[model samples]
Target: MEAVYIDKHYGLVAECKQGSKKACYELYRLYSKAMLNVAYRIVGNIEEAEDVLQESFVDAFAKLKDFRQETTFGLWLKQIVVNRAINLLRKRRLDLTELEDGHLENIVDKEEDDQEEIQYQVAQVKQAIQLLPEGYRIVLSLYLLEGYDHEEIGQILKINENTSRTQFLRAKRKLMEILRQKGNVA
Candidate 1:
């Protein structure tokens, strides 16, 4: 539909949909690096991330006709890539445990005015994220980085919404601990 052309990638995407492999490759060239980064953030391994990216593109192209373009092509493709990456972790048996009542109680909720942004550099923060375990890292990536709320993250991860909130809080605590250990956070 002409309305689908609102996204700039739709031009090449349309050509690809019409069986133009060159256009398809061009679109891949445009999106692969960013897509790979998304996969890497979720999977926490370069090789696995690359494999997942390739698989997601294949799946996306195969199901290309079903893409309604309600959102941009990139957003749609990102969902596929993220799902594939999370599936890989599921195969690894990601364990998202519920927090004890005391832990949640001890975790005082801080208002924005009461919170101070950490002083860590971006690279330091990224390193800390990568060092987190699979469950925590995935929750953190989906919630904080990808802009999904706790309910959406719970739906994606097949966990309770409360579990997502607990994992997010734990992930933040772990990330801050890592930064403190690295002497990156004051």
Candidate 2:
């Protein structure tokens, strides 16, 4: 049996389809902050993330008629936000590609073993994440914070699944390294 998703805000979405300005504003108010954070995680700049948020809302509203209820409105809007943020990053010529497979062969990720031993403050982890390269940060944010699997991340970023896994591992390794260097880990 398929799981049925009952969105509490379905009525508002319906109203939005009918050009109800109040419903539109309500939806925006409900989702904008989370969506902005999503964009910022991928784009790595608050100003650029704001631009992406605004543009995503505009696109979502304009394309509201085409938004079938295959998923919740929030999920749909999130997709738009993520896509727009990624496109903005592309425009800035951010290097997201992984190095050739040969170079990654010897880099074994021991993150799983190390995670149990590390104890760090939330603030330190957040700061360390920010210090990561754009590619690593984006992959890490999407996989860990945004809750996407490597397969989905690969599809979203148009890269190989192995590449996504590699990036995620490298991100975790780098994050731990940063925390250790700062003496934030216990």
lDDT leader: 2
Pick out the ten consecutive residues of candidate 2 with the lowest summed lDDT: 98-107
Clashes of each: 0, 0
CA lDDT scores, all candidates in order: 0.81, 0.82
How much is the lDDT of residue 74 in candidate 1?
92
TM-score of 2: 0.81
User: TM-score for all predictions?
Assistant: 0.78, 0.81
lDDT of 2 by residue, 133-157 (tens): 9888889999998999999899999
What is the Cα-based lDDT of residue 67 in candidate 1? Answer: 86
CA error at residue 147 for candidate 2, angstroms: 0.5
